[model samples]
Target: MTGEPSSMFEAIYAGAEAGEAKPPWDYGAPRPQLVEWAEARDLAGGGREALVVGCGYGADAEFLALLGFRTTGFDFAPTAIAAARRMYPASKVNYLVADVLDLPRKWQRRFDLVVESLTVQSMPPEQHTAAAQNIAALVAPEGTLLVLATTRDEGSEVKGPPWPLTRAELEEFASGGLILRGVERIESGTWWRAELSRGAGGSTSHARQF
Candidate 1:
């Protein structure tokens, strides 16, 4: 994973600098699955601190902000961060260019709600543990983390910069006292959304939705 994760995304977003092209996952709107979660009030972040990992173009972060969360979205790619700011002029989200492998210490266990969607799978399998741990570390005590990602059956083969995570890989995020509440497999098992929580506190009200 040496230099691969950071460079791959930064390069892809760089190609979209013209505004005519956007990363394949950037649909110009918040992801529908995430929107549904918010609309259902499954994720209620009223004035809570929220962090959006690998928030390319800021759609999800903006959506969380509108949900009344103090949201911060970050991408390792500078181009993506800049484009997000341009796209959401006067947005409440704090868009930043920061690395997942090396986040600021102040951010450790600082978010009441952390959203990680398809970001960990961007790295190679060798780095999945590190990526998951870093992401899990952002959840404050009793806080919740939502992970939405493409999934593949264990031992299945795939070729991708954005590789689909195996269940084993996804479970890595539950380390360090994080509880794996439930996992919802969607779209014929090709996609999954998982909910997790930290500390002795209970999971989110929508834990059953997972």
Candidate 2:
């Protein structure tokens, strides 16, 4: 999320344009965890607004839209947004180019559900705090924030475009009035899945799952 944002994303999309294989995180489908969550909840009511951060091909965003949420997916790369729109021409999801660290002011607390899947890990360590703050800021009061990221053991020396996040680092998202509802290690411990809510009153309402 730091550095010259355009340069970082331009180089990435440029590689894709050159016929290189898509990045590892570009799974070409909605993330399984998101699918599961959607199936478990009544999110298809057409009454909620959802935002997917760094939404590469907008698969997840499109999925949310299909399920009746007014979904918007954004990425730092304009190429990615264009590709997403083209890929899902019939999709109701709104695809746009936007930065997580410097989001539009009107978007502040505008979504009912904010999803950050693998986006935090894509940035350098120095940008994690700012990225977390900005991401949390997008959640409306009582909205849910779902995060899925690669996880690393404490003190592990892993070099990466995706510097795997530690458990403690993920907890930092709980700052700025977001309450941690739960954290789970999934996919054979390679990923950390967290669900947080924005509100002062504590409740365990999210414990239900299908």
**C-alpha lDDT of all candidate models, in order:** 0.84, 0.83
Instruction: Estimate candidate 1's alpha-carbon lDDT, on a 0 to 1 scale.
Output: 0.84
Which window of ten consecutive residues has the lowest lDDT sum in model 2? 201-210
Task: Give candidate 2's whole-model lDDT.
Answer: 0.83
Q: How close is candidate 2 to the true structure, as a TM-score?
A: 0.89
TM-score of 1: 0.90
Per-residue lDDT of candidate 1, residues 69-174 (tens digit): 9999999988899989999899999999898889999998898889999998887878889999999888887888889999988998888777889999889999
Model 2 residue 185 CA deviation (Å) reads 0.4
Question: Cα RMSD (Å) between model 1 and the true structure?
Answer: 3.1
Give the per-residue lDDT digits (tens) of candidate 2, residues 61-140.
98888887899999998889988988988888889999888899999878878889988888888899889889988887
TM-score of each: 0.90, 0.89
- In Å, residue 71's CA in model 2 sits off its true spot by 0.8
Q: How does residue 14 of candidate 1 score in lDDT?
A: 82
**Candidate 1: pairs in clash:** none
